[model samples]
Target: MIYNKRLILAHFWLAFALFGVAILLGEWQMFIRSPLHGWLRNADLYYRSVTAHGTVMGYVFPTLVAMGFGYFISEAALGQPLVGRRWAWAGYYMIIVGSVAAVVPVAMGLDSVLYTFYPPMIGNAFYYIGVVLVVVGSWVWVALMGINLYVWKRAHPGAPVPLAMFANVAGAYLWGWTAVGAALELLFQILPVALGFATTINAGLSRVLFSWTLHAIVYFWLMPAYIAFYTIVPRAIGGRLYSDSMARISFALFLVFAMPIGIHHLFADPEVGAGFKVVHSIFTAMVAVPTLLTVFTICASVEIAARLRGGKGLFGWVKALPWANPQMLALALSFVMLGFGGAGGLINMSYQLDSTIHNTQWVTGHFHLIFGGAIVIMYFALAYDLWPHLTGRALLNLRLVHWQLWLWFIGMIVLTFPWHYAGLLGMPRRMAFYDYTAPGMFAEGVSVVMSTIGGAMLVVSAALFLTVLIRNHSAARVDPEPFTFSRAVHEPVSLPWALNGLGLWLGLMIALTITNYGYPIVQLIMTPEGRVPPVFVGGKP
Candidate 1:
């Protein structure tokens, strides 16, 4: 039994560590602001901590969990062992090394740039090395994913791709393409300059290139969420996918539009041209089509399940649906949270509207709601659902799990909703301390009091979550096998050959990119002599 146990335990441990660090950082940044208030805050330390948090949560946990899921899917769908077990282990160690190396400098207060360390401002050289280690480690996973996809396609020939493998491959390809921009910035621009191999680097160019990666990374982070939406949510609701082909089409759409729209991040940056920003802004809005499709499809699948189970009326199905079920609850809340957050995103992506809200706490409010509130809630739900079975034990406390989710959702609303108001009222993000000493200068007292209250709520909610996780680990009479879930209905899907293909989607991505960015990017690289140097605007002006 021990020999055959999945590596899910290891994945849980890593996710817990990373999540713990993130919550603690949230606490520190929210409550104790002075440590970072001064400009003298160590760059090396700041960068290290930021990198550690980002890599562990953003890179490590997701990759490990995806690998765990991949292992299961590969066995079930393909009926074989992973092609290279040793390489997988090596990749794991590489991730560990990278995570450790990356965080040490930050905790020590030696690295201080935020997670995205653009050129000219350098962190400890070790920080760059650590990031590279992580990138390379994940690259191996991509290679493995590619090989797996290749083998499956070769074996099956014209047979339809399994929904599970197809989803995974879509994410894998999206990741590969997204990483290209960040990797180039890291390897060719940031690292060389940081290491002193180059005397000067174009900060504008660095940001422009990094812009190519920034937003798509969110998709990488959300892939696991999407995977669960497709693979687990339907089954939990006693239904199969609404349409297998639609799922593929949504993923294909995500891959096609996700990377190119990163320039929406540069909408306010001066270096990137307005035309490019406008083009990306359009794509940014367009990308929502695929996300909305997923939402509609998943919701319809749940509705079908409820109807089949004797639910009645358009809304009666909601009552029949298992709101107490973890995955259902997670998906439900995720849908609600995305609506609020997506509205905020729409404002940010607006070419003209962004100028009014740029760099304000509204941006923070939006991301925290989406990433921290929505995505993290789902992670907890998924882990809770998987851990007990993986550990061969009854859940330590199901009640606590439900309670924690409720508190987290409540806490997130209490914490972030006000930030939206404060941002519209002109609150800034990343400020270590507020300069609200003068009465009537701002809603100084009210804002601070409300934020503090929000902070406390968040802390309490996080404490509940930690308790739930710990209880699961220490539960008595742990079951050795998970409660297996099965779909109530299965649907067969076949697509027209065009819909079955990825070639069309790939072409769309290329065509859109060339039409939108061709001139700006080309001029940036080739006509450097004609360009005026960017003005530095941040001093005592």
Candidate 2:
């Protein structure tokens, strides 16, 4: 247990380092397009940094955190020791290797194809290998979750899966299915071709396969955050989950629908037919139903807690809610951020609006809202909650932790909102330096200024977070016992086997994917070897 906690903390430190690198790259990318280029004019450096930033933030750091959190939850949930501690350590080592391997190539200026790694835009062989390692490492995490679930079900035959374990296991199941597509691409296309095993790879097939992994990966990123919401939020807010069954329903729906919804990403692509895109787009909307339920249920739980605390009225609950409590503050901010971001997502998924905002700064803005605002805020809350427990000492300064959350929330909105407008104005994305050097660049000067100001604020927010984390580490000398979570609500003695079993959700996911993607993929397989790839240029940015 001691070793695992240390291992988890080590990953947290790596995550912090990766966060710094990711944000620094983001700042530099902004500089690349800045009126004052500020040493960011090198296009290759810009691309490499952007790729590293995206991969590190999107995959590396988040996976580490998720794996660490999963390790802790598995023991708690199953009430059994990890089946093989050696296996867990092996997974950890593989992750470390994968993270370093991926970063080294980017740092050395070898490949900067960005996270998607679409063929024809290929990078150095090591880059692909690095990515494969990361994916493989995550597979280990998934495998562990599977084993945990299997063992729990066998040992406690009639018992419902613990809420925390159920959510994590659902996430694992979804990831396992969705990742297969990307895994196929990496193995057959990117890795082989990058290593000189193939002369030319099918970019279309690669992308089509990658599209399978795209949107579903967001849910994978979000599952742990959701787990925290269902398990931690109620306790922190002095309430109970309104419905464990509702959470089960939500996870089941996400597993079934989220995996196959990636086609919406290809809405503008040509190789994939419009019919498939529509199906996926409709699937996209279906996802909103579960999310809406979650939003309402979570808020309702908070309200109930607030009312019990002597608050009055619909609006009064807001004030009664502990705004200073890091968990409560993060959850509130996450909701607001999701509202704005989720609306942008709906716009993107809309066939009409997608035409206008496709590949624009609006797309970037939307993801930042969802990924950074919603997911990252929960990370902050989790870190804050876990820091004292992990360190066996009280947080160095709870007020600073609260302040950091607010700063991060404010900074994110300020940073992303203007990007949305910029997208609408047809400002391109992923470029190093816009013709900002050209004469009359002053036309969009106001937007640029606002964006730069927002970027600066984000930098400040990042600094504040690091400060709090560092302070907590320094205060770890108190040597208090590791704190454990107690149940926040009474759980029923039994759950329906449908809620307990993996088979039903897995079957539903397969059905949805076939309904949505079977024809598209089959058509591609039958098409001639040489066709103008499925790529589409939807406007410059």
Candidate 3:
């Protein structure tokens, strides 16, 4: 039986529940922004919903899921019960309480500063405190993962750490440091102002500090999905991993490159220097290397699966692979989205091309495609794979799973493609509503309406996804096979210290971050002119 079943189930359930709510709110955002009728057609209510939706999805949902999944990995990969079981439970409750603390203020319309650190627009102090609690809870998980790995290594002496656990640890460390920038901004900066201990806030410094976090945090969210691609998909499709070492290198690269490169997000802001922006843009492109490596490795892994199924010649193996299987289908659909998302990302990361779509709907479309489309689809696949093991009840409806993934894929495309087009047409993002009746707005209006239909499909898909899981809860119990991950074709019996652990990579990440961010942040801090008096969103800042 899978270890710590109740805790695992709790994590997945909360994650999906929050996901469902966020999905509904997202649809509403799309509706209000479109020409369609919305129940609450108020701008304040729209921004409130946006704030809540972004906060839940960006912080609470992914962190909880990753923590839960990490706990599962500790047992499934390391063959030990969680080292800090009580701490695990404590962290769980911390997140629950934190989620409520953070979101309640948003619900009451006291905090509408949409998710990211939109400084100069401080909200209720509780909102900032709530998010910190959630991050601290995840840090507990990070500590536990590190402890488990250390304990296992001591006992085993020289064995290569399991690939799943190693990558999990990398992600845990990635998050540990990644949260620091935002944490600093909150505890030392935002909260003080939020509580009226300070009159002005360093809005520019806040953005720079948050830049240390925003991009890397997405990778932390992507870790579980990437881990599944490396460790789960091939096995589910009946093949071994392509290269164990390549997988390690890719993950290690992710650890090194992902954290220090988010300044590219601030390219348009005059407060950031051109040289720093260019350097960050270059490193931002470097982040793509790991994904490229992942695509190659996973494709090779899938090809082996197809070839083993007796497929001949060049592309015939694709036909031989199992499309009906949920994991395989999800992987296929995920790559399709990734291909499109990655193309847009190239434009986003470019020094020159970025200006054309800097604050436009293109940014919105690009992120949603990457996070909501490519990443979240894998989350669904990963959950589906684990459900039978977690609940000891099989998913009885494969057809529903297929349709749900297909709907998400279609909806994401229909939704994002138009936004990309409208961005090119010079439409701005992050606004509650636009003047659809104005000249030259026909295309943008039409695009919003189209994407709203797409958002509706996504809403239905989220509902159907929850239905599939909830149905499994009530299904009859069975002797589900014990959990295991895919093996590499050439699994290493022994490995170097760096590949087997996160220490070297963690040090490298910190050094690189210091190099990239140290001067700019110091400059921002030293320059008193960058400080802007706090502008309260729903109240006095």
lDDT of 3: 0.91
- Compared with the true structure, all predictions reach lDDT values of 0.69, 0.78, 0.91
* lDDT (Cα, tens digit) per residue for candidate 2, span 334-371: 98999999899999888777889888888988898798
Give the true-structure RMSD of model 2: 3.6
Alpha-carbon error at 535 in model 2, in Å? Answer: 15
Ranking by TM-score: 3, 2, 1
Indicate the residue-level lDDT of 147 in model 2. 90
**Candidate 2 regions off by >4 Å?**
1-3, 38-41, 437-443, 476-490, 531-541
> How would you encode candidate 3's per-residue C-alpha lDDT over 1-541 as one tens digit per residue?
3569898888889999999999899998998888776445568899889989999889989998898899999989999887888899999999999999999999989898889859888899998999999999889999999999999999999999999999999999999999999999998789999999999999999999998999999899899999999999999999989999999999999999998898988999888989999999999999999999999999999999999998788988899898889999999999999999999999988989999999999989988998899999999999999989898897899899999999999999999999899999999988887888789998999999989999999999999999999999899998877788999999999999888888888889999999999999999999998888988877674
Candidate 1, after superposition: displacement of residue 483 in Å? Answer: 8.1
Candidates ranked, most accurate by lDDT first: 3, 2, 1
Find the candidate with the highest lDDT and give its number: 3
Candidate 3's C-alpha runs over 4 A off are 38-41
Candidate 1 per-residue C-alpha lDDT over 254-357 given as tens digits, one digit per residue, 9 for 90 to 100: 87888788888877887787778888999899888988998888888898878877889969777888777778887888878888988888889899999888
lDDT of model 2, residue 159? 83
| Reference-based lDDT, residue 351, model 1 | 93
Winner of 2 and 3 under TM-score: 3
Give candidate 1 regions above 4 Å deviation: 1-6, 34-56, 61-63, 438-441, 473-490, 493-518, 527-541
Which candidate should be chosen as best, given TM-score against the real structure?
Answer: 3
